[model samples]
Target: MKNDSYPTSTIANNTKRILVLFAHPVPQQSEVNIFLFEDAQLLPNVTAVDVYAEYPDFNINVIKEQERLVNHDVIIFQYPLYWYSTPSILKEYQDLVLEYGFAYGKGGTALKDKLFFCAISAGGKEEAYQTDGFNHFTIRQLLQPLEQMASITNMTYLAPFALFGSRSASREDRISTHREKWTTLLNALATEHIDLDRAKNIENLADLTINGANE
Candidate 1:
């Protein structure tokens, strides 16, 4: 299913296409990411790619990945944070797929005007990512690299969608609530309910509570 976007969902007919690149090293053992990724795949007009599952060999085909990018309207990089960044395979994919004369440079407008952001599951609690916290840097601060990548590529870089404390003890109800919000956010993104300006202004999608919905 290389660059595949079959119409499995009937949520919206003429909405923008969504590409969710799901990267988990070991999904079966995962507690939070598994549920998040599973729910995302069920959304209509959304192409969710389990990167590791698709390319277990780590030998990602650049052409196929680029083709998928060109064909989608919204792009999501969903993964569990490792060492404050994406997993190795996704880094490898970027180095190979986002090449010269393609994603950047002359005639490299495949991703222009497209929505770019990430959905991350981190072990650190929300407060841990603040100035006075142990981590000392906000998620937004740490994710500047990807945000810069979007800038250079001429894409619209919105605030990230993050879930903190993935490894901590959490109630089943809390996890269920997170899933509901995740699904709602995906639907909003697909249907263009997200106001790009407002999304860009906030720190993350979870902050939507303070800023109100993207509508």
Candidate 2:
């Protein structure tokens, strides 16, 4: 079920309608993203859709998904990083929902000027995602396909807000702090308080402070 219950009229002026497409294969086993999804539900002007819950059979409703995309100003893919990419359902959703005549190719400008980014929770440590580290690539580098997808669809791509070391976060008591940061990031995006230009330059949105400190 989609949480499109929040009315647009109740949202404050100058705020954008944000759509968070959550895709986790096993939410019952998740430590971070489940809480983050709940936090997004409490916020105004944010429509959070659990894609797995909505399409358990992998039968995506292209029209409805496209409509949701058209109505929102920002699109966020919220999920745990599974095998260096999104979960299977999310990839299916994109392949089906984003069609040739709608998302890209000729006369496919339905998502033009919309903002896109990922909110990811990874099992590896932040240091492990560097050029010379274990993964041998930054999260941004690993997510190049989605960035290019956004570019072709005419959406503005922002650096992801990622939480590294997620596997031990709950045991180390870091989940709460990460959840709080996720909420803050969502609020900043909704209210247009974040610096889009600066966001584009950064590798991770989490490193940029919401206030004037990081600029």
Best by lDDT: 2
Prediction 2 global C-alpha lDDT: 0.87
RMSD of each: 4.8, 4.9
Deviation from native of the Cα of residue 128 in model 2, angstroms: 0.8
Poorly placed runs, candidate 2 (over 4 Å): 1-13, 212-215
Cα lDDT tens digits, model 1, 1-215, are 22233222233466888899999999998888788888988886788899999999998988788878887878899999999999988898889888766777876666878889988888998899998998999999999999998988888998888888878625534677777778778888777776778888788785664322234
On TM-score, the candidate that comes out on top is: 2
lDDT of each: 0.81, 0.87
Q: Please report, as a residue range, the 10-residue window in candidate 1 with the lowest summed lDDT.
A: 1-10
Candidate 2 lDDT, tens digit per residue, 71-170? 8899999999999999999899889988876788866777888899999999999999999999999999999999999999999999999999998988
